[model samples]
Target: MASEKTNGEQEMPKKKKNRNEELKLHDLLNDVVSPILFPEPTNSAPLLHRIKTSLSRNAPLIPQASRNTARDTLLWTRAGSPLRPLLLISVGTITILALTGLLVFTLLFLFATINVVIVSLLISLAAAAGCLAIFFACVTVIYIAALLVAIFAISTVIFWTIVAITITTAWIGFFYTVWLVTRKSLGFAKQSLSVTSSAISTYSAAWGTRNLKHD
Candidate 1:
């Protein structure tokens, strides 16, 4: 019985040491993988009800200083002069009004500035687009003009080539006609000279015969 009691006390301490030292990997994994706001209790409530419950459960705790300040202010208003409370209320009201006005003016100014920026951006985009269009149009016009000029130049070269060929042919025909006319005129002149010389010879021979017969 004494040995059993000693063994039991030793087992209790060993069990406690093991329990304290062992890390729960499964619980850590579950918390990391699927964290739950209220893990033990499964909630199937509507969205608004769930939101209200969640907000209530996590409500902020008020500090004691705020309560003391409130208490002091209440006491001051109750026991002090009525004019002091009235003046404080008036000042607070004026401050709130001024802050509200400033907030509204700031919002309006921001909105107007944003509108102006947007308008300026749109105008800039339009001007850039217009300039791009004009540039494209000018390029197209220039391309067309260059094409027409090239065509005109080609046509002028062809026309001049044909005109030169025609003039060359005309000159060749004129030179051939002049050569033929000169050859025909020279032949006629040689034939006429031969006929005249024969006639003169015949007349001279007959006259010499007549003179001898008379003698």
Candidate 2:
């Protein structure tokens, strides 16, 4: 009991750390993706003031070094931008795909579980009959029947394995098709963000150099 208590105490910090990390990731993803899928509206003010306001709210998710890059992304994705429609489409696509995948997985798992139970029952019955045949070695029909049932059980396993592979391939093809449909918009958004990140990095470097020369 003491050892168990010590182990529990040791594990508490690790669990807390994991929870904190998850929360941080959740916040970061929310900041990045929410700007696109669900744009936030800042009060009507000067551009710089609005940017500052938005940055204040979302800056904690990023490090100081990347704050400017995050700000640039925020500007591009803020409400009233033309990218909203693309955002809508991508978000909708992802939502549908995730739900459908969950549904497919659930049904497949259920089917496999049922198949396993049925197979187990058949195998058990075959084993019992085989044991009886051992007692009555003269019973040829019982032996043949047991062999056929064993064969059928093995065939069922192979058939389900094939079905599972075929289903997985079909889902992969479907996901690939959906990705192809949204490829352009997704590519465009990522490229735009990359450009903005580069621009911010260049600007920061130049400003730092100028400050150093002055000092």
Top TM-score hit: 1
Q: What lDDT tens digits, residue by residue, belong to model 2 across residues 1-215?
A: 99999999999999965744445434655665555444547534665655565567666646632554545545666754444444544544555655655565566557655755665566656776876535444344455465556556655655565566556655665776687769978999999999999999999999999999999
RMSD of each: 50.5, 24.6
Residues 1-215, candidate 1: write the lDDT tens digits. Answer: 99999999999999965643442434333333332344335666665665565445333312333444556667888896445565456455555655655565566557655755665565556665887656555654665566556556655655565566556655665676687689889998989898988998999999999999999
Q: What 10-residue stretch in candidate 2 is worst by lDDT? A: 132-141
Given candidate 1, what's the lDDT at residue 122?
A: 58
Q: Weakest 10 consecutive residues, lDDT, candidate 1?
A: 57-66
Candidate 1 yields a Cα-based lDDT of 0.59
Q: Clashing residue pairs, candidate 1?
A: none
- Clashing pairs for predicted structure model 2, backbone only: none
